[model samples]
Target: MKGLLPPPGAVRLLSIGGLVRTTGFGIMTSISVLYFTRSVGLSAAQVGIGLTIAGGCGIAASVISGRVADAVGARNTAITLVLIQSLAVCGYAFVTSFTGFVIAVSVVLSCHSAAEAARGALVAGLIPAEGRVRARAYLHSVTNAGLSIGAVSGGVALQADTQGVYVGLILACGALFASSGLLYMLLPQVEPVAAPSGRGSWEVWRDRPFLLFAGLNAILAANDTVLVVVLPIWIAQQTEAPLAVFSVVLIFNTLMVVLFQVRASKTTSDIPGGARAMRRSGVLFAVCFALWAFASGQPAWLAVVALLAGAVVHTLGELLWGAGAWTLAYEMAPDHAQGQYQGVFTMSTQLETMVMPVAGTMLILPAGSLGWLLFALLLLVAGLAAPAVARRHTNRHTNRQGTPSWN
Candidate 1:
């Protein structure tokens, strides 16, 4: 409240709703895989395949729904999607077979994915252009805080390990979504800005520069998966440190995002500044992962030390990357096509999360030290590439408008 967030209004309402939605999502994420395998009797392969296909379908839904948002209004579209998300998530409780599970997964994934883009469009429409990045950062901070809360609740339920606990968690997630949807409905809808006449999703597809930028951003987004999927395996199998140390890594990451994301966004509030931040973030990630590689094969004490230190460094990279990404996303999109653009950008995240687990684990965990060093090199390349890419977009904007657009 005392920091950089926009004052209480649409921004705050959206943030609160986002918080509730994310909390629900966090709870589901913590146990969903386990529930599918244990309670529903699905094999791991089936679960993975189901989720992957669902995510792929969600990408298409995201692209299409952006146009729907632009037509129906972002606020209204977001509310409908969230409400549908609630019903879909609740439906998970009744799924007794793989087919039912896949259907439920598809509905939840697509609705949530589309809802996020629509909500972003709503923010772009309602908040002043200059304040959009801060508002986004503030919402992200709320997301991190809510995730922490949900994770703790989920952990308790997991420890209890009762059918009732699992059902309760699933139902609670649905309730949270419903509540968020209601809150979304209460928020004022901004007047729609029509896309240039005759333009539609095809125009979005033809935006080569934005597509390239989104692809690059997706590569950078892999850094997020590295913190979650890759690190635990590395610690459990490759290092002598207690697995409990992994909890510290998660706590550190969450705390950093909650406390510093807004402050970090302030420094990268413009496109050029965000480009710089992205460059710096790459170096930070490279160093952090390099440190993680060093932690391997060390004694338990040394491994813990390295892991903790690397987590702190990794969190720095995460903060910078997140801040810069948010700024660039808002800055690059056209005023009238924010929904479509945001949808396209959201696909980058979807792609990263879907692909990064296999790439990071197979690529980084096998070769050990060399793998990590190579991974760092990849980050460095992406980091170096971002500034130039951003500059090109800026130059193109200047050429079209007779001045830089982000300013």
Candidate 2:
């Protein structure tokens, strides 16, 4: 509720650019795999393996890109990454072989991940600390709206189910990425800041507390797999509920995010507040999974109701978790190295996206409802650990003045 209005000039411009980029992102996500396999004639296994490798490359690129942003300037780095993303996407049209497909996708994903790291630096440079997280949350809300539009547009192409339509959509995405890059050109520029004293360009890697925090956030991020990868299967195979429940829940989650992301982001006002939000979110996630587990044996109508209830809880948890993540990732870092710090956080998330589809399915699909419960417990444990870890590691960190902080 805090940031319900459209953001001011900089945030609004950034959101518009972000919207353009995410729409392209949405389009690619919707059709890229299908295009690789169905249109380009690569096998599903090949597409999967290629994408996995691409994701790994993207993760590695984030740290380097963050360093680049700190050296050259974030706006310049972000714009360059977006431009690179456009070219690589266009190259997809030339992919007649699996190798070409891998090469093209790797470039696109790498640029995307790198651009996020650079963009984080850009935002940190442009937006003041007081308004930063809320601005990012607003941009995130806009991003969901753009992605939804793109996904719906991609679905129109999917209905055609022709190679020409798929290729055309990919080309369209390339154009959008180019446009987004131009929009980034419009944002006000800031000079790159130096890394903190006693810190290397790669300080993020050596900051054990930050890594532990990032890892915790990654564990919490597994909630995404619950919705995107596992939930549809659970609806069809585990419950008597119609597959329609999946759509209902997905739509519900999206709507909640668009409406409440800023309100959720308000949790990041301080370290303790963010940690409490994380702890609370874990419980909500656990409750949502438990609700889903209970849905399996229910009659169709009851199962639908239970599933929707679960979605509500999950969405609430997601809001808190995302807000806390933004706050903590930013607050814990020194201002000078925010880009590299953001790069570390982005890499953790990219790592999750690469691994969770297979890993989460392994944990849940094998044992069915029981597996879901076990997954819920894992989330709860992560949530419970939040405050303890924050209290311990954060205490060890000193402010710029050099005395202990987080008191």
Candidate 3:
């Protein structure tokens, strides 16, 4: 029984490291805009530009870091990146000018992206294949719990509005990262699983079917953005649900993830299973969106019922989609280049976040119910297309046995 799980020591270290790192980040996130606007005296536009640039650089760094992980080792690379990230995060407290802010942001984001990529690869190396998705699911739950704690702590700082609190939180986050870096250093090193054919990172780009899979993943990942950016606005403008329902919806989503994410992952052990899960999630999303569409102009009580129903359905879709996407991303990557593949896979999320807010708003907010209907239709198409895409990749790559493992 013990042999079926990851080493207890390794699991403990990883869990602790994630807890500290996420909690610290969460503390800053809730008030980051306030810090940039009030403390740093940056205009809203400047802050947006800085963040956009930072995000772009971070996504690129993730892919590049994969190459580094393959050449060196995932554990060593993750540890180094975390240490550098900690230093860069500390530097954020000192920046006064726009240029300084941009530079600091770039450095912090680059290091953070690279560290995340290496960490994912390291975990894949450490945990047995059978337990990998479950391990990731557990980590995801820990992250949400840590985020809730951080958000509450940050909200307190926001309320205090004192310079010391602001500076202290920033420095404290850096110190936490440093602690995580030290913990990562203590973990046993995992060797890079080089490609059997010695394929380069370029091969990943050349794989058209895999590229399509990643692109589709990015599109589907926009579900997260929709929940964050669109749901609140839609509830206010289109639905008669009470304003307080927005907060309820947020709690519902987080609680659902924390409770059911592991259970969902258990359904998806391989790529085919993952694709099927994702497709089913897409169908659920389409149904949920359709329900949301009908909430527009409904009576208050009816709207509340409809919105609540939609939220439950939406949460189910999210749980399944997240589990399937994580499994697909891990299983479809070449074992030897897991870091690079995972990094490339993460680009879908980056791209989704970068594009979805404006696009989704434009799509759903303008035409009202018609907009939601259109959006739902798009998801339906994507859902139906996912399985066919996976099958195509499987057929193409399975011949020589160099194909990425679906199992």
| Best candidate (score: lDDT) | 2
The positional error of residue 244 in candidate 1, measured at the CA in angstroms, is 2.2
Pitting candidate 2 against candidate 3, the one with the higher TM-score is 2
For candidate 3, give the lDDT of residue 212: 82
Supply the global lDDT for candidate 2: 0.86
- The weakest ten consecutive residues by lDDT in model 2 span 398-407
Candidate 3 on 241-332: residue-level lDDT in tens? Answer: 88898798889888878777778889998878888888988898889888888888999999888888889999998888888878877877
TM-score of each: 0.94, 0.95, 0.94
Most accurate candidate by TM-score: 2
lDDT of each: 0.85, 0.86, 0.81
Pairs with backbone N, CA or C atoms under 3 Å apart (clashes), candidate 2: none
Query: For candidate 2, lDDT tens digit of each residue in 1-407?
Result: 44566666888888889999999999989998888888889999999899999999999999889888878888999999999999899899889999998899999999999998988888889999877888888887888888999999898779988988888888999999999999989888878786657767677787777888888898899898778888898888889899987988888898889999988887578777778888899999999999999999899999999999999999999999988878778878777888898888888767788888887678788787889899899899988888776776567764334433333
Deviation (Å) of 383 in candidate 2: 1.3
Candidate order by lDDT, decreasing, is 2, 1, 3
lDDT for each residue of candidate 1 in 270-352, tens digit (9 for 90 to 100): 77777888888889999998989999989999999999999998899888888788777888888888888888878886787
Listed per model in order, the count of residue pairs whose N, CA or C atoms clash below 3 Å is 0, 0, 1
